[model samples]
Target chain A: MRITLIGSGNVATHLGAAFKNAGHQIVQVYSPNLQNAALLAYHIKAEAIDDLQQINPNTEAFIISVKDDVIEGIAQQLAAHDKLILHTSGSTDISVLLKYNVKAGVFYPLQTFSRTKELNFWNVPLCLEGANENIFKIITELAQTVSNNVYPVNSAQRRVLHLAAVFACNFPNYLYSIAQGLLADNHLEFDMLKPLILETADKVQQQLPAAVQTGPAVRNDETTMNRHLEMLQNQPMLQQIYQLLSQGIIKMDKGTNGKA
Target chain B: MRITLIGSGNVATHLGAAFKNAGHQIVQVYSPNLQNAALLAYHIKAEAIDDLQQINPNTEAFIISVKDDVIEGIAQQLAAHDKLILHTSGSTDISVLLKYNVKAGVFYPLQTFSRTKELNFWNVPLCLEGANENIFKIITELAQTVSNNVYPVNSAQRRVLHLAAVFACNFPNYLYSIAQGLLADNHLEFDMLKPLILETADKVQQQLPAAVQTGPAVRNDETTMNRHLEMLQNQPMLQQIYQLLSQGIIKMDKGTNGKA
Candidate 1:
């Protein structure tokens, strides 16, 4: 497939290289900033363009990988083209693209992308949705070239996935930052918590998080919990988080038991 | 070293096997329940005793791996012995043992233990604190035999580590459960979130979490956050958590900038 990538962000940079590696021709890379477009295009062996009018008409598909707020504006500019248009967003609805282009679909990858880090694109779960079966097949085929895990997810389900990703990925990373802060305050190295964090993640790979849950909250050990609360009294935000998450764990356990 | 385990729970079971593998002698496994003690003792080739009075006198060390609240009570019973006594707890102070036994220390492994899961105990960080240098050396030697990562941490630092572990390990796990529940409610498999979760954890191994923080909150994309909050309107607890954690990430980012 001849692809034109819109936006030169982390997602675009990664997907551009991946598509090129998979033998797909990246015809052009477009960004409002010409320098950013040129840098990504240089790596992917594609032409760099700053203006939307300069997007290659010969391309079979256009992937809008910009921020959520700008996705609609980018899609509107490419509405005149008859080629398939896909946005690599987890939250934005497919209808946003449908409003402009008849050959609209979504090519959402369910993984966090970092410009500084290299990703094994093959393992990324590409959640693809199309305006029609033909477009869906095209996107799925294109997705399968770069990734092994591909699913047909609608906009509603994708929204739910985006929200869940925040809980599972984003929120946890914040908690880890909090832990790092707490360790730094006590003159301790963050390395001490790495093994435990890795093990907690590994547990979920084989078992449900609820079943594998450990610590004071799950044990209902109020003494330890109180000590922790008192220790965090100076940081009221952390104290509130500690209390709420503990309660959430207990409540979930009780709900599971009731169901059982 | 001939050691007697004072609890037959997950910690005692894993440590008992690890100690045996490290070529130390486990003299006895004790629990209030004889069956539990016998089960662990059988595996480690040790005697099983339910009564605290039946504890072997020939043991070189007594490792009390019981609940935090009962550590003092268990220490009180074994106070008459002049040999080393260690409690495997992250929160409890060494003073609890110092008040009883002369040779007192702490042997804390900073890892989540499960009865069904086999741990690579060699990688677990063993945090030790002794009443004196001599006692510290003894406990350190014992810890080194089982784990490669051992640290001589004081009581206050150990308490902080425990609190940090809750944030880094337990709280993140609860967030994972919440994600799992959200996916289930939306007819999505939890497996979809696994790659993202693993990557989130993997990022922290080499980078500071605050530096790698991603998502709507860190991006300050209030549009998506409001959408998520609306989606989670039914679950008030989850809604509150979403708000608090997002605020936390934003605040931390601001603090990091202010410092810079």
Candidate 2:
């Protein structure tokens, strides 16, 4: 399959490299900033372009992997050919592209990507949705070339997945930052919490998170909870976070108990 | 050294097995319920005792690996011999043991333990603090026998570490449960989010979370955030959590930027 990647961010770089490695021809790499496009294009042996009109018309699929808000504008600028047009966004609807092209689809890879890090693309879950049966089969076969885990998900399900991802990945990373800040203030090394963090994530791979919940909140150890709250008195925002998250854990536990 | 493990919970079982493997004798296993005591005792070839009076008089160290509130009562019951006494708690002060015994210390392994899972005790971080230099050396030597990573942490620092653990470990886990619930509500498998969860944790191993923060919150994408809040309108608690945590992330990013 001949593919053109539009965007030069983390997701674009990762997927471009992956598609190139899977024996697909990357016909062009497009970004408003040609320097950014060239850097990624240099690695994948693809032509880099700054203008939307410069995109290769001979390319079979054009994947727009820009920011969520920018997807619509980029899609509108692309010349409508009989070729497939897909956006690699989790939250945006498939309709965003449907307005511009009949062969519109979504090719969302469900994993966090960092440009500096190398990813094993084989394990990344690719959630794909196409505008029609013919379009879905095309994207699904193309996705299967890069990853073993591929699912045919609709726009509604992908939106829910994106919301859940914020809770699972983004929000939890913020909590870890808060923990690191607390340790730094107390003259403690953040290394102490690394093993625990890894283990907590590892546990969920084998068991449900609700079944494995542990802490002062789940145990109802008020003494420890109150002490933690008092210690954070100087930081009102942290104190509020502590109270709210703890209550959330307790409430979830009660809900689980009611079902049991 | 001969040790007696007081309590038959997750910590007690893991520590008891580790001590036995380290070429130390577990002289007795004690619990208020003899049946629970006998189960762990059978694994380590130790006598099981329900009454504190039945604890071996000649034991070198008594490890009280029970609940935080129960540690004091159990410590008070053990006959005060001129021997080391330790509690395996992250939040409780070493002073709790000091009130009952001249030889008091804290042997806190900063890891979440489950009775069904086997732990690699060699990697678990052992946070130790003693009432005096002599007691410190005794517990430190004992801890080194079990784990390679041992730190001499004071009560204040340990308290802060415990508080941080809740943020780094417990709260993130609850957020994972929330993600799981959201997925289940929409007929998606929890497996879809596991890779993202693991990758989020792995990112922190090499970089400070603040440096690597990514999401709508950090990106300041108000459009996506508003969409998420609207989707979560029926669940007020989740709505509150999403708003608070997103605000916290934004504030932290601002602080990092200000420092730069």
Candidate 3:
């Protein structure tokens, strides 16, 4: 399938290159910054366009891989096009492209993209939605080209998934950072917690995380919890995190005991 | 080196069996519960003893792997003997063993232990401390036989490491549970999140987690944050966690920008 890449940010550059590798043709690359567009297009063997006006009218579909806020503006700019169009976003609605005469959909790749690191797109959940069945099928198949998991998720469900992503990915990783900061404050290497972090992730693979919760919080060992809090005296943010999470764990533990 | 396993609970059963697999001699297994002692002893070709009074006093060292509060009581039980002893703990003090009349130290394994899962002992971090230099060296050698990482950390340092473990293992896993609960409320399988969670952990191996933190929190996109809070109202505990962690991330972002 022929695809026109939109925007040259981390996600666009990585996905465009991956799509090209998977035997799809990248017909063109567009970015407000001409140099970024040219660099990415050059790597993917596609034409670089500095202005939205340079987008080919004959291209079957245009993937608006731009940032969330700019998505609707770009779609409006491309309103003259007649082909199916999709914006790769986890949170935005397909309605963002409503002003465009072209059919619209969402082609969100639910994974973190880094410019320096190449990711295996397989198993990355793709949540796609379209205004019509034909556009939906196209976007779904396009997502399936690189991913093993694809879903016809509308904007609302995608919002929940994105929020869950924050819970699973961002919040947990930030907890890891708090751990690192605590270790750093004591002149210790963050590497010391590496094995524990990996194992905590591995455990949920076998059982529900709630079923396997441990530590002072779940055990209601107030003494240890108090000790830990006392140690976090200098780090107020971390102290707040510790208190809130511990309270949550204690609350859940009570629920498990049918006391709630 | 010959090892005598004490307190055949989760940590002891796992560590004792791993030592046997690694070709070390586990000469004795001790537990108040005969069934647990026999079960651990059976796996390691060691003799099971129901009472500390029956403990063989010939081994180089005895590892007391009891629960936190019981460490001192177990040490009191072992105080009647005259041999080198170490309690496997992260938060307990090495001096707790000195109350006994023999060479004593700490051999704290800095990893989460589950009785159901067999662990690679070589990956466990054993932090050892002793009354003096000579006994500390002996404890280090015993730890090196099973694990690659060993530190001569005193009680204070071990306390810090244990606190860090809570952040890395316990809290993040609780957050994973919250994410699982959120998904389950929508009838979504937590399996959908496995890829994203794994990738989040993998990214932190090479990059500072603070640098890689992404989400509405880091972006401080109030609209998305408010929406998430609204969606999470039914889950008051999880809602508190969401608010605390989001606010923490915002503060962290400010710190990085030199605005604090």
What fraction of the reference interface contacts is present in each model, in order?
0.78, 0.76, 0.63
Displacement of the residue B217 alpha carbon in candidate 2, Å:
0.9
Overall lDDT per candidate, in order of appearance: 0.90, 0.89, 0.81
Tens digits of per-residue lDDT, candidate 2, B155-225, equal 99999999999999999999999999998888998888888899999988888888878889999899999
Q: Which stretches of candidate 3 lie over 4 Å from their true place?
A: A99-101, A253-260, B253-260
Q: Which of candidates 1 and 3 reaches a greater TM-score? A: 1
DockQ of 1: 0.64
lDDT of 1 by residue, A1-260 (tens): 89999999999999999999999999999999999999999999999999998877999999999999898988888989888899999999999988874599999999988888887999899999999999899889889999999999999999999999999999998988888888888788888999888888888887888888889998888989999999989889889999999988777753441110
TM-score of 3: 0.93
Q: Candidate 3's error at B256, in angstroms? A: 7.9
Query: Which residue runs of candidate 2 sit more than 4 Å off their true CA positions?
Result: A254-260, B254-260
Least accurate stretch of 10 residues (summed lDDT) in model 1 chain A?
A251-260
TM-score of the first chain alone, every candidate: 0.96, 0.96, 0.92
Least accurate 10 contiguous residues by lDDT in model 2 chain A: A251-260
Tens-digit per-residue lDDT, B1-260, candidate 3: 67888899878987787778778888899988899899989988999999888888777678899888888887787776767788888878887888776688888888887888766879887888988899998877777877898877889989999998998888887888777777777767677788788778777777777877878888888888898899888877778788888888887743432111
Question: Judged by DockQ cut-offs, is candidate 1 incorrect, acceptable, medium or high?
Answer: medium
Q: Assess every candidate by TM-score.
A: 0.96, 0.96, 0.93
